[model samples]
Target: MNREEINKLFGVTDEQLDHMAAEYESGKWEGGVGPIVPGRPRIYDEELETISFRLPKSRVNAIDARAKRNGETRSQFLRQAVDDALLANA
Candidate 1:
């Protein structure tokens, strides 16, 4: 979808967009699109969905240990595991 579509989806007004645009064009704006926030946000390349499943306690412990050791999050470790499994099967 386009900027207008996203704006409409988020209930952003045309005047608001113009104001933000003006701020950016005039070099007064720092960063971010619409609202002012605290720290840097988590940006992803694509949209993500969450799923839940129950695993053995031991298995979860193993995952957490490995993730910490590799300096990665649980989600990252699980995504890598899924990708590797898929590629191996293919």
Candidate 2:
């Protein structure tokens, strides 16, 4: 859809639409005209670490169900749980 369509659909102000159009004309805007991919936000830093472990099938199933109910993936739910646990301990 075009900018005017998007503006009408999202109720964006005319001024905002004009600014976006100007940015597009100036080649300063680089966003794609597609649905955003969902998941964890990307973090490009050395401080981030990756760890993997295996869980029992029953536990994994339970986690998947809970995560789905909460509108999150298993990884997102686990990450938030870990952060909360650390804060609680602290």
Best by lDDT: 1
Worst window of 10 by summed lDDT in candidate 1 = 34-43
Q: Give a tens-digit lDDT track for model 1, residues 1-90.
A: 998899889999889888978977776776665654456565566777889999999999999999999999998899999989999999
RMSD of 2: 7.0
TM-score against native, each model: 0.51, 0.55
**Each prediction's number of clashing residue pairs:** 0, 0
- Tens-digit lDDT track of model 2 for 1-90: 997798799999799877988877676765676434456557544567889999999999999999999999988899998999999999
Best by TM-score: 2
Stretches off by above 4 angstroms in model 2 are: 1-27, 30-40, 43-46
Give the Cα lDDT of each candidate. 0.86, 0.83
lDDT score for residue 71 of model 2? 100
**Candidate 1 segments whose C-alpha is farther than 4 A from its true place:** 1-45
